[model samples]
Target: MELPYFITWSKQKAPTTLELSKNSPHAFHIVEGSTYRPHLKKIVDLSSMSYQASFGLRNKMITEAIKKQMSLFSIALPKHTFDLKKEVSLRLIEKAKRYSPQTGKLSKDYKCFYTLSGSEGIENALKMARQLTGKNIILARKKSYHGATMGALSVTGDWRNDEHLLPRQWTVRIPGPEEDPKGEGIERIILKHGSNKIAAFCLETITGGNGVYIPHPLYYKKIQSLANKYKIKIIMDEVVCAVYRTGPFFGIDHYPFLKPDFIVCAKAISGGFFPIGCVLVCNKLSKRYDDKILSCGLTHYAHPLGLSAIKATLDLTEQRSFQKHADEILMILTEFARDLSFRGFKVRHIGHLMAIEIQDKLTIESLIENGIYASIIRENLILAPHLNTPIRLLKSSLKTLNKLLSK
Candidate 1:
């Protein structure tokens, strides 16, 4: 009999094979005595990714993170609280109150105007800006991914979705300086647009998918200062980079001197246990107008279940200083990259993330075929290892990779 043309084909005679070990609660149907590890399922989830990445390997790491988050979250609420939306919002309301000063801004010192569950949050950000600022054009960086929703897509610069017909408007996508121009070019770009016509300056703290190209250390400080100087509100998009992923509570913490009026965060806020996106606004922007309707709200905003997960995640990082740990992670990563380089795998772990630019596409395919996992980073392979990833396991994976490269 010929083999099946598709991916995997087990022994046809015993196609439904189930071993005695499989029946045991502690074990499952793993290929017996197989030297090479089996391929793990592809991770197509953007939700699982963020500053604090969710589990990738189909193993305990994912389970443990979820279980730990859920345990604290479930304990926080009463049983039978399945509808997590409203409760989640109420929790945010309380959290915001803690941050907002009692008497300050026109927008409630303690109240935020918007909370988007997904991409709609980005759409709402622009909508609110136009409603308040009365400016139609929104400023964004070149090659930005706001969201797929119509309004969010409007200000985006990613060309992958160019064919995707949405109510999109082509606007100014200023070229990021090839050598970190220190915000000189950005200020000139804003001046070019006639600041009165532009509503907001929205950008990522550390550019995502654009090769994790973290801006120069002074980038945000200069940008935030400029937005203030020109009366243009800054909308810092921290969707993938915020929430302790880079070892800081917020990726903005990396640039402590940089103060933005509004900051958008989503991924890792709920620790991959639930959905939660928040827009943290400082008093400066919040005080813009008197009783102006934001005209923005998501039906699932402040979802209780989602909020509970966020609360639990916040609590987990409460005691742990994410910033220090992130710096340490950076150091450890630098060491790993050096080792890979020693064995001849053109590697790069710069910016806030790590990407190994290998010799060719075949090497990537071969790596995935091995037990180790990663994704394409520009023309390289990305390794977004979890905070809990053990170095011993990484070393073991690298040894195998070295052998494969030599072969």
Candidate 2:
């Protein structure tokens, strides 16, 4: 996909590498400027776009604030994502959206719901749950992150931050079947707490980004049955797994019979642009969601730019077969994971994902210096390469890792 615009700074120099690093989103050097800034006021600045600026840097407010407040001087923003000399976020967003055909996976009723940022969407979903059911306490599984927003962190499963890092809301964390709860049942927990205080239950479809840990058989269906029996609403958080990252658009597609009240999704939405996450409410929940201002609003709510990206993404998804993409990815990851497992590594995978706990392995910092920039998930490196990135790249990455490990 063509980027929205091009850069034309006279002092611009070519870059050495396409891969972005922390200091430099891309490798570049400066050409001698014809003139010099005599003072701080004369510095030129830029944003994502490569436009002329009067400030000497981009995102100076943040950089200067951090430098003075934190007492540290550093470059965190890359010229591409951050410190570019122009305001081209919209261009970056559009380019990102078009760069990948499949933005996200969705449930049956989606492709019609409004998308918002992750925290924004989660808060709205919870608000809807609160208003419709009139239940004060929201239950979520432990070790999950809805978002960083006020109301979102409330229902977030992780308690490490809730006590001081977030606001106090009527939130409860329910142990999943894996947590080894006291009883052999979720029904027991519901019966003990009673459904009157609990408005809704939210959990990821496959526990992605949280470990890609999937629940056992009849897990969701049982949850659905319990909610029905107790008159509580069920919401599935498919945000991480909603994109084509997992085998299906919506991981909950594996559990349609569960008939969740709401599905919150966003990752890979617009292929990482537009920050378009949505809570796809069901027919029943839709009727209950009403004319109030939604109790949650962001300046970028349904922003035209994001909506445009989403519409284009969805259109591309329909035109392109993301399922095929998922299938191919699954096959590749499965083979790679199986090979790792065959070598005595504790390899586990779901869909096109894999997380292995290989001990006495190579460290994170060394791998990068070796030119392998992988998302280090503890001892396991998270490898979800872009679909457009060639299979050779994946193979080369794995081969390089294996070589490094051999040393």
Candidate 3:
């Protein structure tokens, strides 16, 4: 058979059979035996940690989902279809409802909508906000990352998404929580734009991508007060921070007093088993679309297989043992981050998520040599490990990393 060729992210050419490993540096693709070192799939998905599920790997959960899906042989339909209620879609919806904090009496009401990825979920949130409020402008923070799609890219403040930034005039970028921790700039922007003209304020409860930057202690509360006073919907992008990644069901859960109108989530929701994104909205917002038609959907709006994967992943993460493991991992990550800081590395972290500013690309190369798959986001190294990653592996990797830094 003839060999296959592929184009790299940099537009370079290479053979598809190159070593079976080192092909997917971006985590967009997974190469088995190499990506999840020491312990095949176990390392990549250690419970509440990072979920970089690559294709071609079938763990027990994935196999079960596949089996269930094949057995049912259900037709693909829009998730809202009432006729499909008896199928896997209903189970997914019920599971989603259990995960949504907005459904409680004390909290703002919520409804769940499933998407194919984080970007789609974010786009849906923006669309919902604009349609419901009949406003065009959106408020996003500097250094924030919601997703890669046009609508999401337009609102993203980081440079990575700059190439995809189209002329979306409605998104207003404000300084991040680190710069305007008190959210004073948000109020100024709201006033300047005339609150009535603004559809929503989009924010990452804990900013990712640009480095895992935690928000100022009072940031959410201040933004919440501002949004409430002006009747602007608050869209909290918890895509990377939910599903126990940051010690909460939703990242916004960190701020109990604040009530964001929308929550966009993905990643860990399926425990890295499938590509899926979810939008959880307040009851008030859902009512707006109850009679009116929603203006967003994709071909795979809610794939049954994807929903099955989500249900299985949620079941795994919600187990008491998994929760305890996650708690322990958080502690370990906190101490690990502190040690790195003492070693003169600039570290930023919240819960199990962390980012270290390692400016040299060679250090990243060195990390790979040491068998630690570190995610390099711009100038920083994302050091988030799976919740079930062996503690010894982490320590060894850290030691190797520190040695590399010393040199």
Best by lDDT: 3
What's model 1's lDDT at 62? 32
Clashing residue pairs, candidate 3? 46-388, 109-283
Q: Which stretches of candidate 3 lie over 4 Å from their true place?
A: 1-58, 79-105
RMSD of 1: 8.2
Write down the TM-score of every candidate: 0.70, 0.68, 0.83
Over the stretch 1-407, how does candidate 3's per-residue lDDT look in tens digits?
34355443233443332233222212222344644563222122222223343211344765587568768853476754533324444443343342334555454556777788888988999888888888989888778877878888888888746666384689887778778878777788778878889988888888766788888768777887888788888888888777666677667667767777777878766656667777877777888777888777788776666777766766667678877866776787788778879988898988777788888744534554454556676898776566555556556656766677678
RMSD to the true structure for each prediction, in A, is 8.2, 13.7, 5.3
Judging by TM-score, tell me the better candidate of 2 and 3. Answer: 3
Question: Which parts of model 2 have CA positions greater than 4 angstroms off?
Answer: 1-115, 159-169, 180-183, 290-293, 319-325, 359-362, 405-407
Candidate 1 ranges beyond 4 A from true positions: 1-52, 55-118, 166-170, 177-180, 287-290, 320-329, 339-352, 362-364, 398-407
Distance from true position, residue 141, model 2, in Å? 1.3
- The clash number for model 3 is 2
